[model samples]
Target chain A: MTGQSTVLAADVPFPPSVEDFYLPSIVPWGGHDSYWFTKITALLWISVALIIIFFLVTYRKPKLVPTKKQWIAESIYGFVRNNIAVDMLGKRGINFAPYLTTLFVFILIMNFWAIVPFAQISPNSHIAFPAVLAVISYVMFIYIGMKHHGGLKYFKHALIPPAPWFILPLLIPIEFFSTFIVRPFSLAVRLFANMFAGHMLLLVFTLGGFAMLNANVWFAPFSVVSWAMTIALTFLEFLVICLQAYVFTVLTASYVQGALADEH
Target chain B: MGMTAVAYLIAGMLVWGGIGLLVDHWVGTKGIFAGIGAVVGIGGGVYLIVRRLGA
Candidate 1:
């Protein structure tokens, strides 16, 4: 430790460090504790409210001709409904469009918050949000499986699969652990890791660019190049934001489909 | 999606292997149970992934 000489870093503007990619808190309290109105928390609430407002404004009055706002809303709904739900679940998916659509849009908006001006960090970059979403999906599929297949039968179908009875014992634990435990855990980890990585990449290029600006006169031009990379990555983040949302929604639909199906 | 499969596979091994270690402690055995648990976990994980995700 450079002791007294060491500087206050990243989250501060004066000197940039890689740690700037994380450890910023708009709220004074611990996130795991009560009274945590951190930046991520606010963004999560705002994302939900904005999405509600978006839909309300667009479809407040149904129009035959359709205004531009209505068209945008319809397209978003149709895209998720047709492309994700219907495509994965077939005709059986028609009833699920609303649920899947809302899930898709919510995840998209929360993730896209990372690139927004004042809200440069995504809430899903944190593990808790993803975990909650994943758990909801897990419980949903489990409920569907149980309801459709019957209580004991659902466990039988899930644990035994279509395999022969001789090997059922070995497969039971594997299936139980993977389906019950791993599904939600992996779902959460996947979303959290992607958002976390994307944010880090942006922080790296943007802050590195600014820091390089004063590294030396000769290195100053490279700072511009770094800033350019940051801009490029921002656009990439847009694709990632949409893609992750779509992927999550599709997987959830697929899980539902699997539960309803006669066989795996 | 591919990464999820990988995570599942790795998670299975770690999770089951931990269980095996606990069992080993309870039974006062060596690493035998843990090794078997790990291999079984890996095999089961790969089998499930391929069945679910393979085209």
Candidate 2:
């Protein structure tokens, strides 16, 4: 068994870092310089395109009675509407259903890319992507808040937090800092950091298995355990992908609600 | 790796918080905008570390 284990480890190939992961560019713009940006951007667009095409194909003809694709589309829409928006934002949430649905589905697809065989990297794992999404949410909430309430009142509501005047000295500044500044930043970092760490962990176990295999006969059997853990973790990552996407969308709706609320 | 991760998380929170404060000040509204900014900052900071290190 030990002899076979060592041989098995030597035969396996471990996955590498994102920097080392080679994805063929859809259209090769340049070789070395454009490697990260061109390919990654193209893949990102592909994901976006797939999403659009999916919806378009599924809902080309709307009907009271649905087809499989339409059902998928409807189910996805319903999930976001009922589970996230309504649950988090209440009756007012119905208005935000479309935006929340888009956020959830878009993020879910991007995250699912990590588990896909050929496309193993998650777009959200890239800080820039999450940062952009965070900015979008920030703008959406702030704009809605200001648009609904006068800017002066909105700012007052955000900072004041319905507290006493004496406490105002300390509370006001802190409220401003948390509500305006920290919300969006955490919004982006939460998604980015989770995906990044998940990908890195998967990489570590995968590579460790391979490295151990070659180290000695005794190390070979451990590769089986490593591989087993990796498989289990992959399933957990799937849950995370969905959970994170939901969390992001729900939080976005919450922020929007916060902005639109008459009082803090 | 751990230190780098911590630094990135902290930096992200501070940058966002600072931006929030600047935005509030620029808009010329008086209230505890700074307080909101700090809450958002600390929330983001803790969220980053938890998301990364937690399962």
RMSD of each: 4.9, 9.2
By DockQ thresholds, what CAPRI class is model 2?
incorrect
Task: Please provide TM-scores, in order, for all candidate models, with all chains considered together.
Answer: 0.81, 0.76
- Determine the iRMS, in angstroms, of model 2: 9.0
Model 2 over residues A169-247: C-alpha lDDT tens digits?
Answer: 5445445555677778888999998888788888878878877777767876897888788899899899899889988
Predicted candidate 1 versus true structure: per-residue lDDT over A79-110, tens digit per residue = 98888888878897888899999999999999
Candidate 1 clashing pairs? none
Candidate with maximal DockQ: 1
lDDT of 2 at A160: 61
Runs of candidate 1 with Cα error greater than 4 angstroms are: A1-35, B1-39, B45-55
Q: Could you give candidate 2's fraction of true interface contacts?
A: 0.00
- Candidate with maximal TM-score: 1
